[model samples]
Target chain A: MSATVYIPREATALSLGAQSVARALAEEAARRQDAVQIVRTGSRGLFWLEPMLEVATSAARVAYGPVQAADVAGLFEAGFLTGGKHRLNLGPVESIPYLKNQERLTCGRLGVIDPVNLDDYRAHGGYAGLTNALAMEPAAIVKAVTDSGLRGRGGAAFPTGIKWKTVHDAPGAKKYIVCNADEGDSGTFSDRLLMEGDPFCLIEGMTIAGLAVGATSGYVYLRCEYPHAQDTMTQAIATAYAAGYLGADVLGSGRAFELQLRMGAGAYICGEETSLLESLEGRRGQIRFKPPLPALKGLFGCPTVVNNVISFASVPIILERGAQFYKDYGMGRSRGSLPIQLAGNIARGGLVERAFGVTLRELLYDYGGGTRSGRPIRAVQVGGPLGAYWPESKFDTPVDYEAFAGGGGMLGHGGIVVFDDTVDMAAQARYAMEFCAIESCGKCTPCRIGSTRGVEVIDRLVAGDRTAMQQTLLRDLCDTMLNGSLCALGGLTPYPVLSALDYFPEDFSTPAALQAAKR
Target chain B: MSERKRVTIPIRVEPGTDLPAAERTAVLEAVNQNRALEGSLLPILHAIQDRLGWIPPRTLPLIAYELNLTRAEVHGVVTFYHYFRQHPPGKQVIYLCRAEACQAVGAVSLEAHAKRALGIDFHGTSGDGRYTLEPVYCLGNCASGPSLMIDRELYGRMTPERFDDLIAADAAGATSAAATSAGATRA
Candidate 1:
């Protein structure tokens, strides 16, 4: 057997030239007569180190990167195959603080094994949750998830168990598990990371959800933006079916669950649950009125359990490790780990899955190592485009759901995009409204007309109009949007807009105000 | 279990489909293949778009006819989503990320540079039909932004200089670039 080398096939890695690096490694090894086995695995989510490569030695897998095609010759000369010293060599893979410090309960399988390899997945405790769930009653499975206190990782922070119980108790012989993989958030990529890196985990998670809610059919509503993930997940689903982990009888347990992958065309409203169900039924991606919550009537009017990718992926661990074990990791009502995607201008951006109490300060400074531009960090946007902009004053805020909501910021998918002093908060506020206008489903008046008006008002404010008047009008518009819109697209757009106006008032001043201050 | 039978949606050239023979056949095939699947309209539209570059105007009524849906129903879905293009697109479509993460990293300047270099505005195709520029919210490459995708290929940490080079390389049919390696290696 030859020495084994691991390289990432994750979209981020490919974007940063891992495919070229893969070809380079193969070409270089052949030229040097050094036979080696190269395997393309999922990313470890330490994106700053990608296309981060690892070599399996006698003791452990030694790490070296960020590798490029040009460095292939030097790496071979340095005896990288034998774990030789090189400037790019970061030593062992596990010693890196980003990976070491993470509470990787849900993201543990990422980059550790071939994502499509069922045998490798099984070896790494993949099916233990399913194996355990197969024997238990459906209610018991629901009780375990409820007891674990896992809330929706999709930003709403709704308890997963209660949602499952609603569908379970709803009197229907036909129920469906719909995984919301329509991750359209600007700064969030945790769902894309899991679907591309640890795909089988999502497969297992959704399968378990089917059993819990008595649903025999499942569909993953993936956004068309993530073509790489679509390919990987489609392949992984096929592998599971062949292995009897999916379709008619899962793992030969005498239970039936069929899974399919459905693609969503570009529509941000589809990320909203009611809108998501409408899109799944082949209609215009419109929002439905919400008296009959999706738990009761969803996805073709069948009782459906709709979960975010991370919410479902977190289930296997709770079932395998027991509710108490999973519950013990976090603070307050938030149990288990949240896969926080540290993105944007941060120095060491990647996925950091920590328990609920982790602070934004720790993630920004300690893990992220501050801005990549080496400038004074000005603002951070937690969640996606809809999340509020946290000024430097709020950096110490913890990652708990209630803590964020208390601060007028919801932990809607944990993604924090950092910006330096060069950022224009007023401009960002304009964009928040602009994005809403562009993606609105046109189902309501407030979101549709108000967003376009919000942009016009902000433009007037930015163009040195009556400052106090414009501010009041903008606030009034945001109020209408928050209270009047049917879904979060219109509802949550106010968070970023109002937060900018409130916290960064200096950035909102008119030219007259600035000149008056100078005088 | 039986091999699932496909649902056949018969084509009606009601108001007359003015498409070329090859194009019409491909559209018919896509709709017929996906007819039996649940919520198959989106899939059918995707298939037609994938094969013909855009959803041609003539194919809509035929599609509506086959799916047992009205032209209004099919047209509503096609126009609702940003991904579907009504007219034929250029050889390459560039989805430039204009969202906050990309904006934080100088995407505003990058967007300006792209517009100037391509001689086209957002959603505009070049005179030569070489490229079409589209403003996208995010390409899921936020950490390495400014991000953009040329067709299905993703490019990250884009600068004006690198942008020109990538366009040149892509024009030459090269699949890779010098990849401004996401800034220097991990510290």
Candidate 2:
């Protein structure tokens, strides 16, 4: 019998040299004349410990990592094939504290199954949701999602059920279900993680969405940066089509549903629903005015259900295990688990999928193990580039949508980027305006002109030129952008700038304070 | 920050450069593959860029003619997208993450190092046309900060030293490949 070895093929692990490790293991095994099978799986989200290797033992899968190609020969010498003891051995993979603590409802099979193999996906209870959804009526399916209390994980936190209901109820012969896989936010890779780790899960979720919304055609508007995910999804889509999971008469249920993959060309604004729709139509990715929301008229002037990758991916679990089951997990209106990506300067940075109400301190300290630099963590930016910078005093805030909002923060896409004491809050504030300036779709005056002005004001403030007046001007500019922009791209850019100015005033006041003291 | 500079540069058509008959056929084939689909402009442009290294000015008319759209309409999309280059790229394209997440972990200095080492700034190709450096917002490898992508392969936890090694290795590979092709020509 051949020994089965698991190595992650996801982008993060691949970036860390997982391919060379796989090759080294294969070469070592062949040199020893031993038969071993290497299965490329998705990352388990323990990024600090990747190129993580797992050897299937009789009792369980033994883990070893932060492994490199150079360590493969040493691993073989240590008899790691039969779960032999080594310096890098991490015991059972499941027992890793970083991974074991999380509630992985949406990310349960992330690193467990072969990404491209359909049979492996099925063996792990993959299609149960679609199978269960197939027997039920479309309205019932919508009700199931609604009752789950799931909201948009793409930062808006709008009720997912309500959005689906609108598309389901909207009178249209040709409604479209567009999966927003254009994850443009920095420090947010949960969407990319899920798409690369379990491509079929996203496919199944989109299929279930198609069935529920009575839509025949679905498109995944993926970003061009995720080449690995794009390839994985393209392959998975073909496999789903071949296996009767995607085409017309899906699973012999006589329901027609087709899925296609479309790549976005380097436009951050395209993550906006209207901009995404326009980009899909092969036009400039500029934001369109709302009132006739995307639900009513979208994608070639048809009613459409545009959802984030995580939002659609969370549907299968809702349908598989009743709505009450998913709703039982989270607190308040924020139901189910949030896949929080812990990134930037953290010791044990990875994906932490926990239910809402988990405090920021718990994620920052317990899960992340503090900053990688061993210095005091000055600020942690929850959400993405547009998210607010939370000071140490505000770290006690729970990871709920309303709770974060109340504390002048947002749980946008659950991406938390930690910064140590060496961070410059003033630079971060300036960057917020600059990022908005770069990515704004130019349709709105406040976002387009205001952001560039915001950058100038911040520069003046940072450079000690009229510091007091510039601070007030910066706030006024933020308000204008917050109220006057068309989409979140322009609207939310103020969060980071204002929060940085509010939390770390010392960073911004240094040059001014020095000048004042000199006087 | 200067009231958003909107400079509309005229598209430069290099005179005396005609699309090869075979390349023209390939462009038409690409157009034909996607012309039947709704909103085929982006896909058609991507297909042409994929077959040919970049979207040549000559191919735009062929694509416009095939898709029944005006040349300006096609040109607008090509220019709107940052990924679509008007000229051919170098042998390798290095997309360095310039976003805040990467900036938190020495990406600024790393960017400086990359520019100095490559002797090129963002969107500039090296004199030998061996490498082109481009700025990317993020590569979704934020957990491992200071990430970069060379063509399709992503590299993380990058430092100035590691970046230099990568460039040297790529240059060596290019040199060897050139040697092999030159030897074949001599034979």
Candidate 3:
């Protein structure tokens, strides 16, 4: 093993020339006779200062960067590798305000370790949760998860513990734990970051689930678009098997659990658990009827606990820190920290993990530092494309499921996409319907047909259909889709559409004068 | 040239192409592994695509035979997803984001210009076997919209000027045609 330096430069970091900086460091190290290995790790979510470099030493690793290749020799001469003072004065990385106050549970080990290093993973509290669970009865493990108050982070906000408990209690000869890594939401890549940045967290999370639910197998249904994440996870799983964390009788425990990754073909609807389940089973990704939920009859007609990447990723922390420790942070029933992705027209657009109920106003103005365009933030699209568009007046809406629902929006995946004053809400509303139309699996009439028709209606409305009759028809279609659709795809597509109509009525007012030409 | 009409490539199975016996078994096992999960046919098709870059025209019969469906039924699943391609790809895959966010940031103009420059539409492989163009939606790095992913490397804030420079750099870096072709087929 040689003295190595790791750069926490994700794709976001690469966009800022982190690769060149890494190469520069490698060259400088090479000139010194001693070899230096530059391992590219995931971003620390402090995306503002990417190309963040950490140099290994006997003590704590010293960090230096957002440094360019141009300054490599100067950095080396200044003894920056040993954490000497420099112009970048980030001052002992742990002291950085954005990172210091963060309640990092899911992202605890994100940028600290080499993504593929199984040994590094073990050194940093990686498999402790699995180790703890391996010592207990499966039912006891399920109870611990239940008490943690961890909800699904993949939009739905379903209780993770209850879902697992149901699978544990359900009568089935075979059971499964599926990680819904098909994170297709436009403004979200937390799942991708976790899988690529820290693959072991997901492995530990899945292993714990397998032990709790009496399941012998787990599958991570990753998106095809994230080929890097898929490859990272595949390598990690192989390493884990070699280390005895996966595949038959894990860690000397009598429990048998095998983990696999199933790649999704880039369909947005497959993010829906049932569709994901269907896709995993070699079928078209159409939503299934509830009632006979996956808890009862899932993969191969056995009880399966399906959850988003973050939900399971939160497991180790819950187990290690105990239920009350995990639950103590949040306000009200929305217990625990959420990995909120602040994206779109925002200055500091990256992951902001905070306790639940950190109101949108604070998150937008205080944390995000307002619009990146220097224009007034006109609107914010919280959640994915299907989420509602909330204007400035609703910014006070607390970042919790219930509060968001009361404000005519759902806290789908905690992905807050800000939009500046230059945005046309009418156009945004149309795109929402258009997105739904494109992604609907055509399994049900309401989603497949309603989405296409919704696009047409939105177009008509945009075309200056100034009559009250047209507005009424649009509202009625929204209501019908919300009530009749089988899944969130069709049901929530109207949220953005109707929210736009409600908040920005001026967008609907195309005068009859220029309407003909505009249309 | 006039705007090229989009062709929905039909799925077919081919028997030729020097696939080893182990690889053939691996492909069949991939189909079986996915089918055993949820009894869904689409996942199985996606699994095949994941392992093999594009759905080989010959694998449809193998998939069809396993799933107890005709060739057409299997074909439908492969074509439905924009991620799936019927033809074998070229050397370097250039995936340009054409979603709403990217379009809002001028991806539309960039995409059109790129296609014109390369003489290929989305899913079209350049005649020189250097690059294949693909259209993707949002890549989740929207703060720096108008992005492209070239062989697992995400390039953001992509402008026409930078795009030209990237192509030139890639041409200069080409050590071998065979290696470049392999890189183009994936990502």
- Best by DockQ, which number? 1
lDDT of 3 by residue, A361-407 (tens): 88887877887778888888888888888889999888888888877
Q: What share of the true interface contacts does candidate 3 keep?
A: 0.32
Candidate that scores best on TM-score: 1
Over B30-64, each residue of candidate 1 has an lDDT whose tens digit, in order, gives 97898888999889999899998899877887888
Candidate 3: where are CA atoms >4 Å away?
Answer: A1-4, A34-37, A56-62, A465-467, A511-519, B1-53, B56-59, B66-68, B87-91, B99-132, B171-187
lDDT of model number 1 = 0.89
Report how closely model 3 matches the true complex, as a DockQ value: 0.25
lDDT of 2 by residue, A367-393 (tens): 999988899999989888889998999
List fnat, each candidate.
0.60, 0.59, 0.32
In CAPRI terms, where does candidate 3 land?
A: acceptable
Native-structure RMSD, model 2: 6.5
DockQ of all predictions against the true structure, Cα-based: 0.33, 0.32, 0.25
The ten-residue window of minimal lDDT in model 3 chain B covers B176-185
Off by over 4 Å in 2: A510-513, A516-519, B1-18, B174-187
Chain B TM-score against the true chain B, candidate 3? 0.73
Reference-based lDDT, residue A473, model 1: 97
